[model samples]
Target: MLRDLSRPIETGMPTYPGDPDVTLAPDATHGADGYATSRFRTGTHAGTHVDAPRHTLPEGEAIDERDVGEFAFDARLVDLRPLEQREAIAPEALPDPGAIDDDVDLLLLRTGWASHWGSDRYRDHPYLTAATAERCRAADVGVGLDAFGPDPTPTARGDTESPASDGDEPDGTPAHDVLLGDSLPIVENLCGLDDLPTRFRLYAFPLRLRGGDGSPVRAAAEWDD
Candidate 1:
């Protein structure tokens, strides 16, 4: 059986703050051009997308440069549901390393955040802590999440303080740094994880956009009955 783990991308769908809004404008219609087509525009990191190493590291590999074999893997789904809004999913939340299959190449975290897909609350969803990212890195597996990104808390949007003044980086994306620093790929905004088994085959191929930092993916899982 096959289950789609991608979130539906539609016009006016909720997007990360400051990211471009999705727009689908008709370019050709059956009544006008004898065909049906539309112009689709969205950010590369839009819903159900994969982030390549270049997403965070300046000298890292781009999505198109990655080997196709990396996109398909044996995945283990870890459920961390019933968490409060803006909660930090620490390393303790993950399953024991011994419990994970030796051959598993991917870890998909299900936080049940998809329930608030189109709401403002979606922006306040929980995120993985830096320690959890390090754990995944140590396991040498790709990671996927049901939230916007891996930061446990939102970055200060309009804060004018600089790192020199605040004694901290204006935007601290530690999760991305640790994972992407090692060239690990991350898939964000996954959905329908509740329908998947603990172990399944994940096929999430990103677009071969040259020099692309990330690309939207049609992520899915296959289970054998």
Candidate 2:
């Protein structure tokens, strides 16, 4: 059976704080243009999307430059629900790395945050700590989460400041750095993971836009009963 793991991208859908809001307004109607079409305007990272290395590293490979095989892989899902709001997930929050098959290239975490997708609470969902990213990197698996991003909410860090001055390393984005630095793609805003088994095959190909930092993906998974 195949289960769609993508979040529906529609008007007023929840988006990252700085990202543009989704707008799916009709541009052509059957009576006017003899066809039905809608105009879509949103950030590339909107909704269920993949993050390429260029999302963090300046010299990193863009979405189109990476191998197509990177997006499809053996996946394992682990539940980390009941995690407190704004909590930073630790390595212990995941199952033992040894329990995962060596061929498992993707590790998806179900944080139960998808239930709050359209509310302000979605911004406060739990995120992975740097240690958790390290663990995933060590296990040689890409990461996916059902939250806004992989890092904790910026407000939770008690710093309301914007990006630091030039030549200063930005803080509070280690999860992206660690995983992307290793050239591993991250899929965020994934839904329907709760319906998947512990092990499945994932196919999440992004738009092949040249030099694109990232692209929204229609992530899905399939497994045998």
lDDT of 2: 0.84
Model 2 alpha-carbon miss at residue 131, Å? 1.4
Off by over 4 Å in 2: 155-170
Question: What is the C-alpha lDDT profile of model 2 across 1-225, one tens digit per residue?
Answer: 988989888998877877788999999999999999999999999999999899988999999998888889798888887887777788988767787789998888889998888766777778787888888888888888898888864432343433222332236689999999999779999988776888889899999999999999998898997
Stretches of candidate 1 exceeding 4 Å from the true structure: 153-171
Question: Candidate 2, which ten residues in sequence have the lowest lDDT sum?
Answer: 161-170
For each candidate in the order shown, give its overall lDDT on alpha carbons: 0.82, 0.84
Candidate topping lDDT: 2
What C-alpha lDDT does candidate 1 achieve relative to the native structure? 0.82
- Pairs that clash in candidate 1: none
Compute the lDDT of residue 185 as modeled in candidate 1: 73
